[model samples]
Target: MTPHPPTWIRVSECFLSLQGEGPAAGTPAHFVRLQGCDVGCHWCDSKYTWGKSGGREISIDDALDEVRSLGEAPMLVITGGEPLQHEGVYALLARSLGRWSRVEVETSGVEPPRMSHAHLFWNVSPKLPSVTPRWADTWAHARAWAQAPNATFKLVVGSERDRDDAVRLIAEHEVPAARVMLMPEGLTDDVVRAHAPIVVEACKRHGYRMSPRLHIWLWGPKRGV
Candidate 1:
């Protein structure tokens, strides 16, 4: 018999944190943040995780063991820089789906999903023009990700143009209103509070859901929750 090489991945950090945004907000979740991102959104809070150099490598089995020791969080979130960027994450999801009551993958939708549509809660946020000018590429992904049975869309609103574009795309792509969420973009509590009105007004006018950066309100802008 031959031995198989241990599957390893670049991990920025793993922690037990409250899901800060999306339909599962406030849920106690185990978070596995992978390193490296091609999306390159300028306003991304986790900039320390922007490239391959940011995180350390660990075997997949060790990561699972660490999460097992972190107490019983009901949910597991495989997020990133971009989780889908690492092929080993598919293995992570396969092992974790049985452990957590719920599992989510928070993604920017820059790359196509490779998870074989295994049951997952995908918090799919297609970056708006304010963050990056990748219109055609991202929307193409949005259209596909929106079709997942448990997917939800969250767009970050920095200005009216961003809000308007969100509405335009949702309509063009025909994503359900209740499944679409809008969050105000900011690094500070006050800034998030200030920008929230714009997001609220957009939600009111268009009937989209609203997501508060709950972690920011509770703990301010810091890494590792």
Candidate 2:
């Protein structure tokens, strides 16, 4: 007998948007934003997704159906309030693997990724000391993800100090410089513009890539992109 898929998953919002950050930037994609996150980053842009309760419940079928309806977008990004917080996410990713050319999971690196698949790409964003209190867990999770061939380390940089911290973390974890991305922490166009040069310089110095927040530049932190 075929096992049943999850009847419902706690979802904040799902939409079609361009890949806003990391190496896949500017690519058209489907986004599944899940609810609930315990990794409290003070500067989090998606704070609306921080709580589990406020989200609307979406059945697995409906969620998949929505992705299918997006017509032939090549990428699907399952982001969060820390997506790994939900068990249903694994099943969702498993179901999405073959359908999308790339299945990327954007995570906080506070929780270890429990599901593994050949096509899975992990965009592991490790919080710096300026934001999250749980450094040990975040570092450990980041290290694990770094070992995966398809995983990319996207460290959020708010200042020179944060850039230094990101450098140390990448070195400590032995993550490849090519797979490391330094993204400026900002919610608006001006903020991103102000920080972009600093982040760009840091990336050049450290041999890491720079990831800009494209959606924020295009839509100014608006919900639903």
Candidate 3:
């Protein structure tokens, strides 16, 4: 008999939605949103996931069963308020989605992810100081993975200072220009359009990719959208 794996994770929701950001934007995908976070970003859209006890605590098998019910998609996006909060999430992906799915993780880049043998595409968005407290250690971890081989570092620039900050972080982390993404910070359609042109121009000037927040445009920060 095989040993059963431990189940640990707070899941807010899961659904089929078009990829709303990064290299996979606009693509059809399955999303798994785990819960809990230590890093507090003021503008974090998913504040509902911050508490450990509020959301539904789900087993990996049950989560996979939900995914299975949806049939196959080209990719799966595992995200969270901080998905790495749960120890068992890594094994769950390895045992389940690793077989044929292209797995993508949208993270704040504060904690290192635990994944093995999956085509892991990491979209690492590090928080700005304006949104959270300054921690050299957390920033270090963000920098380390932000510059990892298979990861993309995205900085959400809301002001000129933010852009400059991202540039400095890139240098500090030794992240290549090719791997950097500059996304304007916006939570609404009007807000997105307002910031898009400026950030897009900045990306072109600095030779980085401009990541538009497609989820906001598609669903307007509505839950499960």
Better of 1 and 3 by TM-score: 1
Please list the Cα RMSD from the true structure of every candidate, rounded to 1 decimal place: 2.5, 2.1, 2.5
As for candidate 1, its clashing pairs are none
Error of 1 at 91 (Å): 1.0
Worst 10 residues of 3 by lDDT: 134-143
Candidate 3 local lDDT, 1-225, one digit each (tens): 986656756788888878888987888888889888877877778999888777787778788778657766788888887776667667766755554457887778777745544377888887766778843434667656754657888778887777777787777777788898888887898987887777887788879999878899878988875
- lDDT (tens digit, per residue) of candidate 2 on 1-225: 988656678888888989999989999999989999988889888899988897888887688788668666888999988888787888788778898889999987877767677778999988888887876578876666877768888988888788788888788888889899998888988888887888899878879899989999999878887
For each candidate, what TM-score against the reference?
A: 0.93, 0.93, 0.90
In every candidate, how many clashes are there? 0, 0, 0
> What is the lDDT of every predicted structure here?
0.84, 0.84, 0.77
Candidate 1 positional error at 95, Å: 0.9
What lDDT score is found at residue 168 in candidate 2?
Answer: 82
Off by over 4 Å in 2: 1-7
lDDT at 3 for candidate 3?
68
**Steric clash pairs (candidate 2):** none
Q: Candidate 3: lDDT of 198? A: 74
